[model samples]
Target: MAADEPTGTATLRDVARVAGVSPSTASRVLNGGGRAVSDDLSVRVLAVADALGYVSNQAARALRGQRSGVVLLGGDPRTASIAAMGAGMEEAGRERDVAVSITAVGPDAETHLAALRILRGLRPLALVVTSASFVGTDRELILAELEAAHREGANVVFIGEHDYDFPAVRFDDVEIGHLVARHMASLGRSRPAILTSAGHPAMEGRTQGFLEALAAAGYERDAIAVESVEISREGGRTATRRLLERAEKPDMLLAGNDVLAIGAIHEAHEAGLNVPRDIAVSGVDDIPIARDITPPLTTVSLPFMEAGRAALAMALDGDDQADIHLQSRLIIRDSTVPA
Candidate 1:
């Protein structure tokens, strides 16, 4: 090699050294790229970079070559649905050679706008919304903004039951309610109670479907008792206390999910009610912990692993002609039967 070539190149480390800060911190400020570059550092870093003639490495700037594919999953942080779906979606992505990322939409969070802002910098191939409903938090006018992102080139997939422009693979919550209700009724359990948080769309759908089935069976609303509470185990305990306060408590209890069902089971024991003899119990979503309880919980089950695979398939095809409502099942166990 000829020794005549000039050695007049500057690196990011040179800029950091001049700025008297770490190289990573300098990069963060400079790469903020028109976003909110937290004030003082932005000015200081760029100033020092310019003074030292630190040019960004174009060779290293080739990002597309380094990535195969990326998928983003968004959901409400508080819900178990997010954890369940997030696990399945990520596994699906890994099977297909795609890197998966997750973001939780904090309470009253503007997910759509935040996602859009995030996308301008990183180009993920698709986005999966992990929950059924997002309360309309119109912070900084986010809903319209996310809608624009969907219109533009983003592939959007909703994880639960929804009717939207985006393609979704959802479980049928309505059918789930019917399955559990019919199971209880067939067991000759005349008085059935439902417990849930009405704010969640999935829970609401379950309640509606359960009530509809009862109406078909000649039972009035009063006969089909219901209690509304936060969709938590503690909330279940409290709701159970309310039911116990009544002179005539239900013989069958249908909890919205395994968590509440587990709590209701505890309450039933506390009240000296022998399960299935005094009161029977059922739940939905056959969670991992369902079988671990004293008498394993009977539940309306969903094939979530299959749903995960299908969601990615739909996302890749980018054609949603078929709104696939995957079937749910009633898993019979000791809780709803004579032990």
Candidate 2:
């Protein structure tokens, strides 16, 4: 064959011929069922397939009672946490020789329903959801679709809390709250204020745990103040300003996430209050930006990448009863050092 020949009409036979392998070997390697093949041979087969522009025939695979070897990951990719989860899923999918398809959608009932409808048409081997809030309000429709997927031998995995019956990779938000609060108390910061988002399960759980721990540490109800905000940088800044204007200012501010914590720090600086001096700040989900900010943030670290990998494993490996609980750890930074 000419080197410049068109590959638009390429087939598995063409790939096998180019790679010096049999058609069966090419099929096994390309279709992802040839785990016993030598690494060098597998690499050569994949490279040849790419050079020949060979694409798997999903229809033929389905006719042969085999799955399409695709996994669907549904969530908003704009969020930092969800984006990290997507990256993890993609890495795992590549290792398993499975294709990953992402469907970006908003966090609303109608949007989730629409995304689920689109997902059903794909008939993927599994569906992984990084956020439960997207499907929170339309549980009935989402659950029905999940049941149908289950009946069709497709798996469903959730990365966060959900009321549905699917397997989940959950973070210990309550425990993270307790850890952060206990750490703060250990630093002798008794008067603490919480800045959190309303109607968010993760945020609410963290707040509840923190308050409970503080109460147990001999802090009275009047000494602690909880404020609900938008769970954004601006929300943190605005809420912090309000807290600082009070007759009695809090000694520490606990934000729902790093973004809010950054905002709180900015506000404290504007007010000329030295961090860990006049006031201290802490947050959850030790995002990348947390460490880069001035006077690095004290926060709880959730295993975002591990959660994604676990969710994909549960779905692809058919571990329906798998309830993976990831532990969160407290990371003390310069922001929370005792004066």
Candidate 2 accuracy as lDDT: 0.77
lDDT of 2 by residue, 53-106 (tens): 776655445565556554444545666787777767766665554566667755
TM-score of each: 0.73, 0.80
Candidate 2 deviant stretches above 4 angstroms = 1-43, 47-75, 135-141
Residue 324 displacement in candidate 2 (angstroms):
0.9
Residues 192-307 of candidate 1 have per-residue lDDT tens digits of 78998766778888888788776676667777779988767889889988888887878889888888898899998998988868899999989877888878999877877677
Question: Can you tell me which runs of candidate 1 are displaced by over 4 Å?
Answer: 1-62, 65-81, 110-116, 133-143
Candidate 2's TM-score: 0.80
Per-residue lDDT for 322 in model 1? 72
Candidate number achieving the greatest lDDT relative to the actual structure: 2
- Position 232, candidate 2: lDDT: 78
> What TM-score does candidate 1 reach?
0.73
